[model samples]
Target chain A: MALSHDEVLHLAKLSKLTLSSEEVLHFADQLTPVVDYFRELNEIDTSNVPETSQTTGLVDVLRTDEVDASWVLSQEEALSQALKTHNGYFVVPAIFTRTS
Target chain B: MNIPLSISEVQNDLVQKKYSCVNLVEHYLSEINTQNKTLNAFLTVTDEYAYTKAKELDRVITDNPHAIKEFPLLGMVVSIKDIYLTKGIRTTAASKVLESFVPQYSSTVVERLESAGAIIIGKTNCDAWAHGASGENSDFGATKNPWNTEFVPGGSSSGSAVSVASGLSFASMGTDTGGSIRLPASFTNVVGFKPTYGVVPRYGVISMASSLDSMGHFTKTVEDSEKIFAVTRGVDGRDSTVVNHSYKAVSPTQKFRIGMPKEYFAKGLSPEIEQKVRAAAQEFEKMGIELVEVSLPHTKYAISVYYIVQPAEVSSNLGRFDGIRFGNNRDSFGEEAKRRIMLGTYVLSSGYYDAYYGKAMKVRSLVIKDFDDAFSSVDAILAPVSPSLPFKIGEKSDDPLQMYLADIYTVAANLAGIPGLALPAGFSESGLPIGFQLLGKRFSEPTLFELGKKYQAVTDWHTKKPS
Candidate 1:
């Protein structure tokens, strides 16, 4: 089944990506076949099968709560790669735009 | 000085004082200067850093010859895939999103390799976000196959394979999420070994698919692969998935039972690849090893299952690239990355989750079980790395599904979390490299490497270089 343009846009929205109208159509065209290809999984009977979140059987692998200095990035290093930062905190556009 | 073939030769020459460490670094850097223009392999060449490292090593060689043994990788030059973060170096992952991003810390693998005295020549190019099989998806440009420039060097470990194949570096660090390392290694005729998942810690490496990604490398010889593996594998405390298991060298006199998965050799595999891989299996038979014909029934569903599971993880892993921390906003992602993200979102979306992501996971269990059953009978499974030989650069770029299909034989190992070693089998009639992979049970790298070493012992395929 081909993904409609609106469906593609919904995916883009959920993914936090802004796509052009052309990209919406393009993605719809491209992703339709891939999604259809994924339908092949329905043919298999996996009712009793359990989900595998990870290959390694290790679970709840925990370390001591103490901080190790070697891996700790200083405040300067932490904010180093940000495009916008102020007073040691990353700056971003307003999460809520007010409209009245 | 001519480029040495293996790490042992480099170590021997360094000890013999045939050439200084600086000469070796200079030779490789010069080769990069000459070949990289056409091959488009290296994204960054660390001439200053390499020289500094080499000078420091030269001092050690001159004064503390006894301590030289401590540095197993002394005088060896290696390359890092752009996906691996090198401290203070720009690691792009071949995407414009992180184009100018300089990492503050190096990966565990990098830190270990450097400590073992490996001189990192540079960061090599790869598919953007490691989303594609062919290197054409790289944001910078496609990495050309060293054998035939018009043809592709299979990716997402494109430049890593090309670097080792063309002698630009002795070995290269790469990630194999879904045959990223093995496919390229097959295309370029290098030994690409993807250890079992969590064998090499994933900390400091750019995430593709969190669950599927396995850190691996490319080398000229199986023994060189073993040396690099020794330095890289271990728990680094950061990546919680890493298991603290040391490598055990296989006995030289050890015999083996190799499996040929019937499903892998079924229809759709290129006849030439089938013949070459069969010939490789025959080589094992000649070594007095048993070749059992095994069956993996769920093999047909591997590619479909991977598309679901890998993208689901990719979507989650890539969500961190929000421009606030490191890279540019979502717009900087290439077409392939965007497509994967969107696909991942669609699958993991509310109503469709169980149908797609949930189902893929269950099928993934079946795929893993197939390997478990097969391993009970045979020590390792030998199969073609790719269904076909390397095609021309522009051939599969237009079709994403066609490109994903190229990963059929390789994704199974990643899903099963098994160790796979891709060894050069022979050359095609057209002279492109052909390779076959040995898949062993989890943490069976020693057995796979032993098989690879035995194969390389009689066959000169690994010695043949691309002209």
Candidate 2:
């Protein structure tokens, strides 16, 4: 269950995080025991036990489709915390490029 | 009027016109100004806003005495943990990611508290993103235990506990994902109540372990905790997980059968904490309440399951913090945050999902079942809040697993989605406060509160000040 160096780097990428090389070594060392701890669950007989996504038994609790205007934040308010914004939309690194 | 007043005392004083709301607030701010530097309890002090609100409320109190009934929390001051968003107030969640980010909208609970006439005095410090049990996880700096500044304040509700313990605020709103409120409350000798999941709206608080988080508060007394709980509990459309039903208070009598989990008293629990908690359990027995010994066989697996599930949820929830849309880029996340995210990503990764996350979820059901079985026979369960008393600063900083184990007795409540109340049990031999927790069935806060009131009646531990 010990996470390899490359595996730790891959996890950081998957988590949308960038770890310094030092962090990789540290996390790799720390996370191994934590992962090994998870192995304890395997000893329990969970063959037919259902997975619990939420402790509270609520499921698919949908509200009315209409918006409550009073509580809704304006576009400007919503974009106020954005690190990069242009006009009313949040700006992000471009995800696509046209290649012929 | 005295500088430190309980919620009820403040109300009575306000009713008799002994002091204006402005005066009470000023006294509280003055205390904060003097003690906060050493306590490190607050992140931002909202002086102008607090004074303005208190002065306006004082006008209403002066104009019509009966008008106070409309605002139940009228004239009482409370602090909000930085994890809960407040409009125009900088909420760091004790992390650099949102160091200067102020939300345009306030959280649902804060709105409810304000409408009830509670003035926002300041923002308290906490573990970043409510992540660690120790206050050391905070990027701002660790909050000092008001009792002894040298010792660490139990956290991630560290500041919330410190504020109440130091007489700065009557109560503080804190989020408990995994004993964030209760653990600190134990260390500081305050009342920390984590209501059942889905009881309080989670709309404005920053998300951490979405399913595990519950919005609760720290108070000087169980009655104060109940009063605040009544105001803050309920469903808001924004947080669909909240329950729509109201909690009815039930009185405790001889018929109460409280359970003591045998596993909790086992290895790792400090001898002093176990002794104090056992003494408190004996008091309940003296009240004619039967104490039944029960076993939660899966107790050992709780910390493991929690670490897995919490990290997985944290990774997914933290995904919103991409540079463009949120406060800052992911790089700003601290070492603990990065560690959790990485652990989460590794577990939920395609091939490993079934082995780690999937298996952990199943064991989580067993942990819940252990409680369900125990609750069937007993009205509630009594256990130590933490395995040991609060340690010194930098004691567990280098070791993550050791820090995680500090929440041994507490994480089970979060995993089971039950209401857990931490109250002053007694003090350790060295004079540090030791607390025991009473956990009741989901939404059975009334039973826990009733028992807590009974316990506090016989014991003056909760009333003892740090000094």
Candidate 3:
């Protein structure tokens, strides 16, 4: 179960995190022991047991289709925290660039 | 004159005109100013906001003295762990990613606490994303344990415990995903109570493990913890997981059956901590209570299950911090946060989902069932909050597994979605405080409170404060 370097990079990408080369090497060192230690779970027989996904026992609590005026964050307030804004809209990196 | 005061004492003093609310707040402010530099307990102090709120409370109290009854926490000061979102206030969650992120809205808990007339003086430091057991994981800086500056404050609710322990605030709110609240409470010699899951709404709290996280608080005394729990526990529409469980006040049983989990005392536990916990449990025998040796066989696997399940949820929960939303890019995550996210990503990945995430979930059921079986035979479970006393600052920081092992006795309560209270049991030989945990069935917080208050009645350990 030791993670390869490429696999670690893939995970970092999937996690939307960009790790430095040193961090990649560091995480590679750290995650191996952690993942290897997690092998303790293999010793236990949990063949037919059900998974405890949500423990609260409440299921699909549907609220009424109405707006609470107080809970709503105003447009100005919502956009206030953004580091970059343009024309009252949050500015983000372009998903697509015409580099070709 | 500057001695530690419980929340009730401060409230009573405010009502009796012993001091004005503004002066009381100023007193705490001055204490924070003096101690925060050394303790590093606070991340952001809302001095202007606290003063304004206190002045308003003073005016109201002057106009009509009995008006204080309307606000249970009238003019009382409290601090919040940075994990809670504070409106218009910079909440870092002790991560560089949200270092300058000022939340647009406050959490429901913050709203409730503020409206109840409690003045929020500051947001305290915690481990980044509530990821580490030691406060060293905080991106801002590690919070020092108030009892001894050189020792690390147990975390990720590290500063909350220190703030309360040092009398900077009457009480402080913290979220316990595993042992965040209790362990710090134990280490700092304060009462930390984690109510049954979903009892307190988690609407605006920065979530670590959604399913396991319980919003709780640290207080000078168990009675204060009970009072705060009464004010904050309820259902919120924003958090769909909240259950409408009514809080029924329970009294300490004269002939109660308290369980001492045999596995909890087995190995890796400090003999000193064991002796302190056992001495506290024996007090029940003196009160005509039966102490049964119960076994939670699946307890050994809790830390493994927690790390797996928690990181999986963290990976999903932290996805919102993608730079485009509000904070910096995910690249700003600390080593611990990155490790958790990557581990989560690996577990939930295509080929490994069933082996890792799925298997952990099934074992989680076994852990929950172990608690269910144990509770059927005993009214509550008593155990040590940590394996050993609070070590020096850098003792466990190097080895992550060693740090995770510190949560062995505390995580099962989170996994089972039950109420657990950490009460000051005794002091170590070197005078560091130790706390024993009282765990009850789901929604049995009042029972735990009853026992906690009862314990505090006979012992003065909760009254001892750091120099």
Candidate 4:
């Protein structure tokens, strides 16, 4: 059940995080115990119990359509926290670069 | 004489004119100035706002002297946890990203407490983003346990517990996702109540885990805790999850059948805490309450189940803080919160979703069924809130697993979506405080409080003062 170094690295990359070498080593040690704990969940028999997506017994509470603008934040005030911007659009590095 | 009053004591005096709302608030303001030097409890103190509110209360009391007799906790002082929004006030959640940000709208709990006439003196410190079990995770600094400054106040509601225990305020509001409120209450020796999930609206809260995140309070006694719960418990349109019905109060059984889950006391528990829990239950027996033995085999897996379920929800709930719309200071979220977001996202991604989050939900169902079986035979379950008393400041900081283990007793209640109360059981041999929990059926808070108050009457443990 040991996690391979490549597996951990692949997981981090998919998560969009940049972990340092020191953190990798630290997480390598920490994730060992965590992975071992979850191994027990694999052994339980839950065939009789339906997998529950939510515990709330009620289905849904729908609100009627209404046009109420209370406690709303202005657009500029809200978007000001972005790290980068261009032409009033949020800017992030392209996920897949076009080969030219 | 600088005196700090409990909610009950203050309410009675206000009725007798022993002190006006203005006098009580000014006295507490001065106490904060003198005491906060050592007890790093408050994050932002609202001096002028509190004074003006007190003056207004004076006008109301004067105009209709007899007509103004309502839950006069109206004039009482309260502390707010940093995790809630405090419109036009600095609420950092102890994270550096929102250090200078003032939320445009206050959290519903904050707005509700104000309308009730309670003066909010300050917002207290907490673990950044309410992610860690210990206060060591705060971006600002760790809060010191009031009983012994050398030790840490258990968190992420560290300051809320300290302020109530050290007499800085009559009571304080806190959010408990897992053990946030209970752990600190246990460490600081105060009463912490986590009402049944959805009893208090989560609107405007900086949520950690939506389904499991519960908004609750901490106070000097079980009575004050109940009063606060009554004031804030109701439906709010602002929060989609808040329940719409008022629960009728249940008087806990005179011959209450208590459950002592052998699984809880099986292993890894401190002897001192074990003895106190057993002693507290024996006190219940003397009071003619029933004590029954119960088993919850699935209890051992709660921590594993919680870590997985919570982080998965956190992965979704915290998506708003992408260095864009929310947390303005992109780099200021503490390392712990960043680490969790990274870990949570990894588990919930396409490749590993079934292996982690899906399986955890299945296990959560088993945990809830275990509580359902145990509650059928007992009015409530009694167990030690923490395995032991408060540890030294750096004791569990480096090893995250040890810190996570401190939440074992408290997390199960959250997973089961029931109410749990942490009461001061007794003190450790070294004179530190230890706590035992009284967990009850869903919406059975009054049952737990009445039972806890009955125990407090016979034993003076709740009254012991910390130097």
Interface RMSD of 2: 1.3
Please give the distance, in angstroms, between residue B409's alpha carbon in candidate 2 and its true position after superposition. Answer: 0.4
Model 3, position B113: C-alpha lDDT score: 90
RMSD of each: 1.1, 1.5, 1.4, 2.7
User: Any runs in candidate 4 off by more than 4 Å, and if so which?
Assistant: A2-9, A74-100, B2-5, B66-72, B251-254
**lDDT per residue as tens, model 4, B176-264:** 98899999998988889898987799998898988888899998778778878877878878787778666767644456789999988
lDDT of each: 0.93, 0.90, 0.88, 0.80
TM-score of chain B of each: 0.99, 0.98, 0.98, 0.96
Question: What DockQ does each listed candidate score?
Answer: 0.86, 0.80, 0.80, 0.40
- Across B1-467, the per-residue lDDT of candidate 2 in tens digits comes to 46443677778888788888888788889999999999999999999999999988988888876866788788779999999989999999999898989889899999999999999999999998889988988989999998788888898989999999898988899989999999999999999999999999999999999989999999988888988888998888889999877666574334799999999999889999999999999999999889999989999999999999999999999888877766878889998999998888888999999988998899999999999999999999999999888899998988898999898899999999999999999888888899999999898898999999889888889889888
Give residue B381's lDDT in candidate 4 (0 to 100). 95
Error of 3 at B236 (Å): 1.9
User: Residue by residue across B1-467, what tens digits does model 3's lDDT show?
Assistant: 45335666776777787888788788889999999999999999999999999998888877876765778777768999998999888999999999999998888899999888899999999999999887999998899988888898799899999999998988899999998999999999999989899889999999898999999999888887887887787887888998788766664344578999999999899999999999999887777778999999999998889888999999999988988869998778898999989999888999989988999999999999999999998889999999989989989887777888788889888988999999998898888999999999998787788788778878899889898
TM-scores for chain A over all candidates: 0.88, 0.83, 0.91, 0.72
| Residues forming the 10-long window of minimal summed lDDT in candidate 4 chain B | B64-73
Candidate order, lDDT descending: 1, 2, 3, 4
| Quality of candidate 3 docking, DockQ | 0.80
Name the candidate that leads on DockQ. 1
What C-alpha lDDT does candidate 1 achieve relative to the native structure?
0.93
